[model samples]
Target: MSGTSEGPTPAADLNRAVITHSDLDAPPCAEPLPYRSVFAAAPLAMAVVDPEGLVVSANATFGALLGTPAEKLAGSVAADLMELTSDARSWHSYREVLGGRQARLRCTRRLKHPEGHSVWAQVTVVPLPGEGRGVLLSVSDITTRRELQARLRHLQMHDPVTRLPNRTLFFERLTAALDAESYERGGTGRIGLCYLGLDGFKAVNDTHGHRIGDRLLTAVADRLTRCADEAGYARANTPLVARLGGDEFALLVEHSTGTEQLADLAESVLTALQGPFDLSGRRLSVSASIGVVERHAAGTTPTALMQAADTTLYWAKADGKSRWTLFDPERNAHRITRQALASTLRPAIERDEFTLEYQPLVGMADGTLSGVEALVRWNHPQFGTLTPNRFIGLAEEDGSIVQLGRWVLRTACRQARRWQLDHPDEPPIFVSVNVAVRQVWDSDLVTDVAESLADTGLAPHLLQLELTESAVMGSAGRPLQALQALSDMGVRIAIDDFGTGYSNLAYLSRLPVNVLKLDGSFVRGFQYEERDADRPSPADEVIVEAMIQLAHRLGLTVTAECVETSAQASRLRGIGCDTGQGWLYSRPVPPDRISELLGSPGVRTDVAGTP
Candidate 1:
C-alpha cells in the first residue's frame, strides 16, 4: 500500500529478501547470498522484523534514519525505536501487519531526531512477497514536501494587503473556539469579537487610488495588532486580529471575561485609527465603526455570531461613525422584524394587504367634522395591523413607496368622492393624503394626483397633500416644479410635522403650501390645564401660537395635530388655529365608521385602539 506522501525510490542494486517466522522452522531460501548484504546495500530505510516483534536486521539507511547503529539495532524493539504505538489506531494496524493478519499498513508519522528538530516520514509495512512470517518496513523522508505544503497553506490563509489572517482563517478560528473542548482550557467560557469597518474609506480609495488604500489598510492592521497585544489577557491569550476583505477587520477574543473586555478592545481600535496617517506626504485621517459581540461559546454557530456582529456594526454606522456598539438582543430582534417587513413590503402592495383609516380633522371653533386625514395601515398577515411608522421608511428605501403612494392616493380619492355622494345635503369634506419625498421625485406626483382625481370623480380642491418640512423645505428643479403643478391643478398642500425641521420659515411664502400641521411635541405642552388668558403660556404653547399666527399671516391655514384632550383642543381653538386633528376628535377609524360619523360633531372615541 502507498501513503499520501511520496514513496521511496529504488536503487539499481535493489533485491528481494524474505525470512521465516522466528518462532518456527526456517523456510527454504533459494539464491540467498547472505540476505543481510542485500539489506545493507539498500538505499531505502529498510528494516526486517520477526513475528515476535524484534528488529532482526536493519540496513545502514534505516539505522541512520532512527539515529541508531545497524549493529546495535538487531535486538531492539523496532516499534519503540520509532515510537510507532503512540496512538491506538496506528498501533492496532502495526500489530496486524506484524502478525501477518493484514496485507499491508501505510501511514505518516513525525519521528523526532536526536538532533532537536523532527523529520516527517511516510512509513509502509508489508509482508515479504512469498514469505508468511515477517514484515518489511520502509520509511521515506518527506520533510521537504511537507515544508512546501506548509508554505502554500500559509499563502492561502492570509490577506495580501494587511498580511493578516483572512476571512477563511478567522472563521476557522472562531468555529474552533466554539468547540466543546475549547472551553476546557481554563477560560471564562465566553468568546467575543469586534467586527469593524472603516468610515469614508471609499472616498480615500477614489481620491488617491487602490495602492494608497492598501497602505492605509496595512497601517490599520498594524495598529489593530498592537491593540490586540496590549489587550491580551495572558501570553497565550492574545486576541486574533484579522482582515476580512476590503476595508473590514475583526478582533476575536477567546475565553473573554465579559462584554467590557470586548468594548475596551473596540474602543482602543477606534482611538488608534483616529490619528492622522501621513501616507507619502499625503495626510489622511479616518474613523471606524465597530460592532462588539460577546457571549457563551456554547450553542453558538460561527454564522450566528457573525450575523450579530454585522447587525451591530450597521448600528454603529447608522448611529454615526467613530463609535462602537454592543449587541442588544432586543434591538437585534427589532432589526430582524424590520428585515422581514422590508422583504415582504413589495408583495404586500400587490396582495392588496393595505387599508386606509380616517381620523377626523375638525373645525377648531365649531367642534364639527371639517375633513379627514388618510393614514395607510399595513394589514400584515404575519405581524398583524402595523402603523405607518413601522414600515414607511422601509418602503421609501426600497422604492416601493411609489407603488404604495399611488394606491393610497386612488383609494382615498374614491372614498372621499363616495362620502360626497352619500351626503349631498351636508358640506363636502376634503381628504388629506400624506406624500413621501420619494413619491414626488420617483413617481410623477402631478400625474398620480390628476389620475386619482379623474378616476374617482373627486374634485382636486378637496384632496390635500401633506409632506414633512424636510421633504418640501428645499424643493427645487423637478420637485419644486412637481409641487407647483399639483398646486396649479388646485390640490391643497400642507407641510406635515411642521416646526420639527431646521429649514428657514421665511421660505414658507415661497412654497406653494396651503397649510402647516404643527408637530405633536409642541402640542403636548398644552396638556397643562389652560392657564388664565393674561398669564404666560408654556414655552411650547408660546411657540405653537407664534407659528399659528405666522401661518395665518402667510394666508396658509393651520392644523394643530395630536390634540388628544379637550383642554388641548380648546387651547388650539383659543389660539385661533384653523383646524384640529387628534384623539380629542376620534382615533383614525375604518372608512365605514367615518360614514357613520359624517354630518355629526367630533364625538365618538369608540375604537378600542388607534393604528
Candidate 2:
C-alpha cells in the first residue's frame, strides 16, 4: 500500500488505521506468532486472510464447508472461496477489513458446496486479534432460516386453491412495474394488464358446489399459466398471472410493447378458455370478460392503473360479456364527469347552482306563444352549464330527481308569476314543467305542486305538468291518483314524448290527461320536404295525422316537439297540431330571454330561428 508524504511506512499506517477504528485503544501485534492447533479443531467454519486477501490458513471445518483439504485451502483467495466476490459492495467491505480500515464486515451469501448443493451462509470478517495485518473470517450456515422465510413468503404471496400469485403479490409487482426505474435495465417503457372475470361465475357456484368452483378456478389458473408461458417463450421477461380473489384474475405485463401486445394476450386468453374444462366426472364450460389496458408506465400509479382496468372490465360486461374491451379515455371521461355530477346533484340544489331556461311552445295555427316549457339547467361551478340529458338520468337513478323536480316547479312558477306581473296585460303564457315517474312515487308531488302554486301566486291553469308517455300509462295507484288530483286543481296534465310509448289511447283516455306532446321522431320526418310539397312525407304525415285525429277524438290537444324548420311547423300546423315546440321557435333560453320573446308577436312565424 502507498502512503502520503505526511505518513510513515505502510505497516505503521495500517496500525494507525486499525487503532483509530477500535473502540478501545487496542494495538496491533508486530507479526503473526504462528498458527494454533486449536484453529484446526474449531467447530465453526473459519479462515485467516492476509492484507492482500490470500487465505493464510483455514480450519478443517472451513475446508470441509468448501469441500477442500485445509492445507490446499491456504493460498487461495478468501473472497473467491466465500463467494463474496460476486457482490461488489460486499467485496469492497471485505477488502477494507483486510486493510485494517473497517472494524468489521458482515453479509449473507449463497455458496456452492463440494456436493453440488448451494446453501445460504452469513459471513462475518474482522481484524485478526493477535495476527499481524490479517483478518479473521467466519461463515454461519443460515440455509434453514432462509428456507423457512421463503416458505412463509410463498404462503403469504400465493393463492392456495390456484397455487398462483395472489392479489397481494399482484399489487406488489404492479407497483414495482409502475416505478420509475422499473425498466431502467433496458426495455420498452410500458406496462400492461389483462384483468378478467368469469362470466356468470356466481351462477356456477349456485348451481354447482363451491368445491367444483374451486377446482374450476384451479383449472383456469393452469390454462392462464400455459398461455403466459407460451407468450413469453421467446422473450426474456414473461407476463405474471395472478388470482385476485374470487373469479377475478390479472395478467401483468412488464415492459409491454404497446396496447397491441396486451390485445393479443387478452384475445389469446379468451380463445384458450373457449374450450371446456373437465373435473372428475363433470365437464363444465366457462367464459371470461377481459379488460385490457396498456400504456407508458410513466406518471402512472398502481391505483390509477387498476381503476382503469376495472372500468374497462365493466365495459366488457356491458358490451355483452365473454369478450375483451380496451380502455377509451374519452368514454372514461364522460363516465367520470357523470359520476361527479351525480355526486354533486343533491348538494347543487342546496347551493343554488340550478337555473331555469324556457323554450317557447308556439300555437302552430296562429303563431301565438301559447306557453314555454321550463327546462332546468345546472350551472355547475366546475363543469359550467349542463343540460338535462347529461345529469337528469343520473339524478333519476339516485332518487335525487324528487328534490330537483320540486325546485324546478317552484322556480318556474315564481318566474312565470314575475313575468305576468311585469306585463300584467299579456295573457300569462303557461310554464310547463316535466315530471319524472320517480318524483310521483318518491315524494308528495301533489303537496309540492300545491305549495309551489300557493307560494308563487301562479294560477293552476298557467302551470302545466308534463310526464313521459311511458310513465303515464298503466297509471293506477299513486301516480294515477296524483295526475287526477292535479287535473282537478286546474293544473293541466300533459303526456310528454307521446307516440313513442305504449300508444294505448284507450288506457290513456281513461286517465285525466289534457295534452299529448308528440315525440320528436314523428315530427322529424317532416323536417325535409318531399318532391310534392302538396303531399308531405306520407310515412310521417299518416302517422301524425292519425295520431292527431285520435288525440282530438280523445279530446286531448296535441303539441309537436322538435319542430325545427318552417316547413316542419307548417306541416305540423296543417296536420292540426295544436302547438309546436322546438328549435324552430327557440332553444331553451334564459328567463330574461323568454320574457323578451313574450313581448314579441310569436316565434317561427314572427321569428326566423335556426338553433
Local lDDT at 344 for model 1 = 98
After TM-score superposition, what is the CA distance of residue 440 in candidate 2 from its true location, in Å? Answer: 2.0
Which lDDT values do the candidates have, in the order given? 0.85, 0.85
Across residues 1-611, which tens digit of lDDT does each residue of candidate 2 receive?
A: 11112223332333335433241223334332223444556677877677788997788888877888988988998888887778778877777778777677778888888799987887877776553558778777889999999999999999999999999999999998888887676788888999999998898888889999999999999999999998888986799999999999999999998888899999999999999999878899999999999988888899999999999999999999999999999999999998899889999989999888899888887778889999999999999989999889999999989989999999999998999999887888899999999999999999999999999999999999999989999888899899999999999999999978899988976899999999998888764455676657767788889989999999999999998777787778777889989887788888887777676776643355632
The TM-scores of all predictions, comma-separated, are 0.88, 0.88
> After superposing candidate 2, which stretches have Cα over 4 Å from the reference?
1-42, 50-56, 96-103, 128-134, 527-533, 605-611
Give the root-mean-square deviation of each candidate in angstroms.
Answer: 4.0, 5.9
